[model samples]
Target: MRADPNLYDYWPYRDRPKIVWPGGKKLAFWIAPNIEFYEFDPPKNPSRPGWPKPSPDVVGYSQRDWGNRVGHWRLMELMDRFGLRGSISLSTALIDHHPEIIEACVARDWEFFSHGIYNTRYSYGMDEAQERAIIEDSIRSIQTATGQRIRGYLAPALTHTERTFDLLAEYDFWYTCDLFQDDQPQPLKTKGGRLVSMPYSLEVNDVITYGALAMDPWRYADVLKRHFDQLLEEGERSGTVMCIPLHAYLVSQPHRIRAFEDALAHIAGHAADVWFATAAEIAQVYREQYWDQTVADIEARGLASGGTGFGPAED
Candidate 1:
């Protein structure tokens, strides 16, 4: 077994390479709203349990159902108020189930990226063919629904296969949000095509803030501002990416939406220095400006490609 995934090289955070974003911006701030669909009683997988509770877990299922039915509207309105266009991490089935939500996002000219066919479907234990079919369906459905081809992916519920990266590249995807290894864009080692790792954070993600940490809404707001503050400071030296991943089910509760707004307003206040972009846009610019330089630097450092690929260093 490989010690490291060799997905990317061990590029040190200190003074490696400088990246100045377009229009002399220091930070590319993006928002990923995970608008997903969950099944009440999904088929079971032995390796990974789809839910912690039993079949027809109404509590779990209905909470997510509320997201689609009522909560997402509040989230969307709040985002619109702050002029933040969502980069939706979509469950492709939502296009068929709730076309209205897709229509609303389309009207705003927001972005739609794959989050597989359903949140209930996990990539674990899926053969190569099954995984490929998932990817193919996501691309075709989202394209046909929105008239925009999906260029980025965040694997459903973050279940990724061994061949995930390779298949994504083979399918001409520009980026994947599954890797959380860095604050800046990194070139992933794909067999043939260029694929970038976009920063899609879990720390400040609403689900984490509310469920894992049991944080108060006000503290959640503070966490977001603090997260951005440090990134903005570091970004002065070279460009950095700051992503806030959200789940409407958690953040759109009446008590919490205002707090979420407070955090966004804090960021939006710094309008001059931040470039609010989507995952596809960030991937496009990074590939154009820095992908080659990064690949060469990693290879030169013997961290990836040909040499001892990611192991104990020798003097």
Candidate 2:
């Protein structure tokens, strides 16, 4: 196990170079809808079991099946009403499993980035050949399906190996949502190409709010509004990024769907200083405008080395 993954430096939030997003917006607000496919019975990794219960895991798999069958359309239509396009964190195999969903997002011109082959197929204990194979497969699949070369990565079920970031760099991925270290994009000390860690807010994520925190519809709506309010205020000093990562199965349920709408209305209708952006768009601007200066600041401050995880990563 590594004592330090050494992914990035200690970048302070208080004062550094300023960022001005497109249209001079104070905050970059993007939504990541995790459009994923889960297998009812998937191959197991040596390090972790694929399913929580016994084989088949019918109840668990069916709920996610609901996400594709019913929840996804509900969620997409709602976003459409807001003129919002999804920056999808995709389980790439969904293209074959559910081509209709992929086609719909493509029609909307939503961004598609890799989230591995399937939510159930984790990357733990894989060798270099195996890991690179999956990355190659994802690139080929997404390009073939959507005519969009994937530029970002979020590991399957958040599972990763020691070489994950390095491999992402080698593949020329622009950003990764796997890191929760900051609210703004920061440079990753990769073994290869330039990559940034785009903020994919776990705190306000629907999966966290609904599944982990057990928040009701109204509370989740309130939370989103409040979260945005603070970030927008802070963004005045320098740009901030706000992402509400979502799972359709959790947030697009009949009872919960309106809460999702309410949150978007508050941000889209009530705010003027927000840049409604795709994750890739945000990554491009950051790399062009802020990358050099941010790297210099880290070096000047002597803050260019830190550990990524306390223990070896399981996901």
In candidate 2, stretches whose alpha carbon ends up further than 4 angstroms from where it belongs are 306-315
lDDT of each: 0.89, 0.90
- For lDDT, the strongest prediction is 2
Output the worst ten-in-a-row residue range by lDDT, candidate 1.
305-314
Q: Please give the distance, in angstroms, between residue 34's alpha carbon in candidate 2 and its true position after superposition.
A: 0.6
- What digit string (tens of lDDT, one per residue) describes model 2 on residues 1-315? 766677887788999788888998999999999999988888877777888897698888889999999999999999999999999999999999899999999999999999999988889888999999999999999999999999999999899888898899899999999999898899987766879999998899988889889999999999999999998999889999999999999999999998879889999974579999999999999999999989999878987554343323322
For candidate 1, lDDT tens digit of each residue in 48-138? 7778898778899888999889998988888888888989999999999999999999999999999999998999989999999999999
Candidate 2 backbone collisions, by pair: 159-315
lDDT, model 2: 0.90
The estimated TM-scores of all candidates read: 0.95, 0.95
Candidate 1 local lDDT, residue 154: 96
Number of colliding residue pairs in each model:
0, 1
